[model samples]
Target chain A: MNSGRRQFIGRGGAMLAGLAIAPGMLLYDLAHGRPASGAVRWGMLIDTSRCESGCDDCVKACNKENGLSGGTGPADVQWIRKLELKDSRTGRGVSLPMMCQHCEEPPCVDVCPTAASFKRADGIVLVDRHLCIGCRYCMMACPYKARSFVHEPVHDQKPDVPRGKGTVESCTLCVQRVDRGETTACAEACAKAGHKAILFGNLNDPGSEISRRIKAVASTQIRADLGLNPGLHYEGL
Target chain B: MDLLQARRDTRIFYLLVGLGALVVAAGLVAAHYMEEYGHIVTGMNNQIVWGMPHVFAIFMIVAASGVLNVASIGSVFGKPPYKTRAPLSGLLSIALLAGGLSVLMLDLGRPERIIVAATHFNPTSVFAWNVFLYSGLFAFVGIYLWTMMEKRMNPWSRPAGLLVFVWRIILTTGTGMIFALLVARQAYGTAILPPMFIVMSFAWGLAVFYIVQAAMYGWNEMELNPAILKRLKNLLGLFILSVIYLVAVYHVTNFARHAAFERFILAEGGIYPMLFWGGYVFLGSVLPLFLIYFPRLGGKHHVLVASMLVISGSFCLLYVLIIGGQAFPLSIFPGYEARSSFGDGQIGSYAPSLPEILLGCGGLGVSFLITTIGVRALNFMPRDENTQAGD
Candidate 1:
């Protein structure tokens, strides 16, 4: 009877030990090593020539996918929107979608007091809604004017997309969608019309479409002199 | 109780309750009308996101920092005038904070959920620390007023006064940090703002006290001796000098650097140079100095005018900071640098809309209303054993 009791206790202890070790092993895999380099440095390239000025299909897709209230308005809470610019000298017009550039040295991240706004290992700049105070400092810090304050209370916020009142928000590069092995709303919508103005892929990978296009096209980062090194690039600007 | 005491007490209660009710009513009217119409009714837009609310809120907050001199006078330096008035000063600080926060709430989109500001704290944000510090200061001022000053001084008074003294300095620094920490903006992001804010606090606080005292003494049919007035004027003169020195240093350094930002600040096309020199530095600081320092002309009327201008100019300084910062947009398109947004694009400019102005005016009303009631009810004006208090 004593021998049987000892065997039962030892087995229970062994199971507990394995449970403790499992999380650490997972952490290590996520931190330093991943199979197939699942880690991706997400980037975007926009071809302004192909983008239609006022067609807001990407904006609509983002709003619907995020389940944002219609009252939020495109002007106030723009995750993506088409900007029309008129040249003073030539009177020429330029149209393109504007969103977070996801800068390599994002000013918004530098000024966030709680470190709630941070760049992911894959170079996606995101706001942790749980930690935002809506002080609007990040809005001021962002040179791209990419951040927006939540001015109205939202109802029926999509469970997949975090939302809160009295908080600052901006584009997350569609992190949730990326986790599901899907493209961003803007990219998906733009692709349907065979326009594909926005190309998203890992900049580090030489074989990726983004890398290839970047090499081939005359592209530039918006306000590169600011030294933000934004991952998003504009082709034929 | 005696008839005189009975009448005084009755008058105090009525005014206090009446003013409190009025503030609440005005708040409701503003929140309802403004929110319904959208912030468009106020002078604000995407171009100038903040406006009068920010100016008024900051003014009251900085004044709250200044009111601490009352405690400092009593304990830190043992200055007789402020030392004796310590308790009243503590209460006044709380009153200023209440007025300021009321303005902030009226400006918020979700005033009902302002608690979210506390629940969510972003460490990288100076505004985040401001939220925390403002709340902490409010609580500290409240407790200090109630337990230590409301009654008479107890053993806790000294320690409470010391704690408050230190906290007020931090509060002012945090207020300055709101602008100083922003590296992107050249107008405010210098090491100079923190000290400038502290000195400005002294000028503002003393000016407020002088005006209130003059008004209160007149109302009570009491004579305010010229000696006391002279001392107040002297302090005001000193603060004005310091403000002038700081302004000169800040602008000179910026101009000397000759960066694009420096040109933006000092140049004619930008609004900051106009506001800072024409309105704040020269008009606000220098004009007041002339009024107070020209010994021959430094009479009561001169001192009063100088103080009023300084007060007005201080407010203009806050406006210039907020508006000037936003005027320069970030997205300066390459290969086509046609002077950025304001200089070329005509993208956006802000003017405080009606609701914005009304809410801001209401904030001033709230401050005065509180000061009046507090003076009447709480004996805010200190009692000289040789004379009556608030009479």
Candidate 2:
């Protein structure tokens, strides 16, 4: 009985040691983990034909998800906005949303003095708040007018989307959600509102929904003549 | 001849320094208020991120490079008359740069993170290049000044001056490229901008130098020789004409490629057209040209008036360029007019607030104070052979 008890004690100690080493191995992987591979290129497709006027569901959802409040001043921070367009020649109008195009040759990244503006391996462009000097050169360089300078101090920020005053910001394509294998808030919100206008998927994957849609329909990039090769595309202008 | 030995502790000197100090104090206070309360108090918004502060800062920075031209002429070209003015040119360059850089740093939303700007570099960025150029200018100019002032280092003065001359051109090129490299703005993306800025520095720098030289002469009860005065005025006239030619070519080229931008700047733009025609063309270019070319109407006084007008016009021209460029909506959708909460398809409006004006004036004041102190402590007075002959 004493020998049987000794064996039981030894086995229990071994089990405890194995449990202790498990978390350290997991942490090691976390520390040395590489960024998302270039195999996945995130992109979006918008069908303006299905978009409705006066529907700000995407904007509202983006604000909520990013922890932004409505500001009436000229210097207000807005990551995404709905634009109403009118063609002078035809007198025809359409409503569409405009945000960061996330171009392959982003002018904002090129003009930033501190390398604060950077593009991820997955093609998501972001501004590092710690390094941005608020020179607004990036704002000057953005052709889409997609960037907004944070003129006021921010309070009650979402932990995931950290922002501060004097830093330039733009649409992140819901990078936090994308990392978790979820669709962007703006895309999800549009579908939930029954518009079904925005489509989000990997551009690199031919089997992805965005790729299939692009192959099926003729899509246009805004200011395509600039040769920036933007990730965002629209079906109807 | 050493100015430091001269009795410089006069009531007028103290008065000038005190006034300049007050203006600098006012600017600091305004910058503090802007940073504390947020940029909401100012006219700048998300649409017009850069405002009046940039205009002043750019002018000072450009003029700083240009002001060194007098020294370049002396040391590089071996001009006898300009040799004596080299020390003053060096002093003014340092002063103006300090003032301009101060305003630029103060205007930053995160001024505390300047160390990051200095450390982290983006090779593709024009701004990143400017960081190296700006610091290098200070260091090189400082060395050049030391070489000029120290009798033992006189042998090295010519080489140091040549190096600074080359550096200033590169520096000005970088400054011009700040706008020229912008593919986003229709008014900016031209190769001529760098050369235009180079000529602009020549014109603006000479004007500033003339004004300060006149002030110093007046304080010392000295007469500026007519021969030297004529040479300076003629040089100013030539620079003004070159600027006019460049301006014409820039507009003509822009009109051919970017018709919409040209139309907005030349005709349809509300404040832009007015500022362009009334301020830049009329006051900055034409009036100064007339004042410098035809001296009979105002005689010697006309030179001073022309210089002042030239300076004033530079401000207007920069305002039209910087503010006007941002005011026009971006042509994202070529065929479609855009309307949004962010003021899409609409011209952005800006009105300079009190704080902004004070901040600009403070830069001027800082330069003025430095010039005053520098002239008192250094032998910056121009002593031409002709003046000495008269004596």
Candidate 3:
């Protein structure tokens, strides 16, 4: 090929590449390097009676969105799991998903040696992957069994949901989606499944749907006596 | 002068050094594999996050704090008999701490990132405070050793020893609080854990000192002079009793409210109950007490055996506390029968893998190596009035 033709092709490719990346650059600006605000507290509420015992769309959706392996093994990581409670005498069973109950006074945050386990300004508890030394103190301190240490080498991780070996992890209330003014993957899946069991909203806003529902019903926070003041709520025994 | 080394069989010293090196190398290899493969290669899972490595690490750290009791008595309390053994006491403290801290750092999922612990200070974190507490122990004990060894610095030994004695008490409290302050598990969450650990350290640390002192004396074809043996054994007996009392209080206090949890440890939980009764309560506590306090069992030989039993019991006791405490499921569903595929409300089972055990043994190897080298190179041999003034 002639030098002029080759140069023209290369220039065209460069322009195409820049065109492809311009949207991402704008999105990065859209991300705007903004800080999580303390004024906005993200939360969830679950109506157990609407949740089906056999259905686990939330778990599947979480695995798919978070790039988890979806294995139920002793060593496998579970951002969320179905916990079934059975009354011994009555044989009445209640099923609900258990996960990180983002608390106002998170025990995990208090015990972390590196301050790797931290609460964002918006009251969403998170582990700073950079600082976490895999001490698992947060795992030990968590009251809800919300955390899981990555036992094996993680492969095919979703770019948005970063995970690795040795470090502890848990449900983030789908911070990535929440950051985009979207709801969690689990909540969306639960609603799509027609259960409408999970509710994700801003607890900081008195006008939010979750706030209205919690106020309307006799919803309760699991382990309220611990006084963690969890953002998550549940209704029905 | 060097009864165990210069004039006697240096062959044993080299042999032990070789053995210790081999164990350390094996541990490094095991640690490498764990790091390479992730903790999935080991028995640890989400449920039993802290396992055997923790048992060894905590034992070594606690024993390190307790080992200073010898120096405290000699210098701070101004006991001449203990003064002769002060240097040896300080040396063992450094050795045990180094070993314990090594295992702890290496066991992390991201061991390379351990420096982050120091850089990012979490004021509320007990573990973060321990990073300073543990490092300070090495520094203060090192200074204390210097004061005892350097004739010119003899005047400073008391102040330095007093500082170390205080530091050690705080250090053990930090270690105990690692579990004590943990409210998530049923087995922990009492303020008594700190005191319980301090008392346990007294027994465990003295137990370690006795074993090392015996070996050193035995290597020289000498016996621990019966008078010194009597005083030490009496102290060990008292410490052992204190450990029992504190442990009983911890369990008894749990009975009224946490009865099921207490029963799970005492009887219902299969391996836990067995280890508590057979390994810790009986073998570690009862037998050693019998050996130390029994009228006819006051011989030097009995003390040596008793020390071995005490050390064994230390391992069993720590395993029960660290691993067994973790094995009990969390109280997620407080008042109902809870079940999950994730082992919620289920007794978490963990069997230490070979690599994990080696990683733990490696800590012992490091301790052993340091002691062997320290004794051979320096005047760490206990120089009480009963023995010839080797110095």
**Top model by TM-score, which number?**
3
True contacts kept of 2: 0.86
Q: Against the unseen true structure, what C-alpha lDDT does each candidate score?
A: 0.71, 0.88, 0.89
**Top candidate when judged by DockQ against the true structure:** 3
| Clashing residue pairs for model 3 | none
lDDT of 2 by residue, B20-116 (tens): 9999999989888888877777789988889998999999999999999989988999886777789889889988988888888888878878888
Instruction: Give candidate 2 regions above 4 Å deviation.
Output: A1-34, B1-9, B295-298, B386-391
Report how far residue B292 has shifted in candidate 2, in Å.
1.3
Task: Flag the better candidate by DockQ, 1 or 3.
Answer: 3
Instruction: Compare the candidates by lDDT and give the number of the best one.
Output: 3
Give the i-RMS of model 2 in Å: 1.0
Share of native interface contacts recovered by each model? 0.20, 0.86, 0.90
DockQ of each model vs. true complex:
0.19, 0.65, 0.68
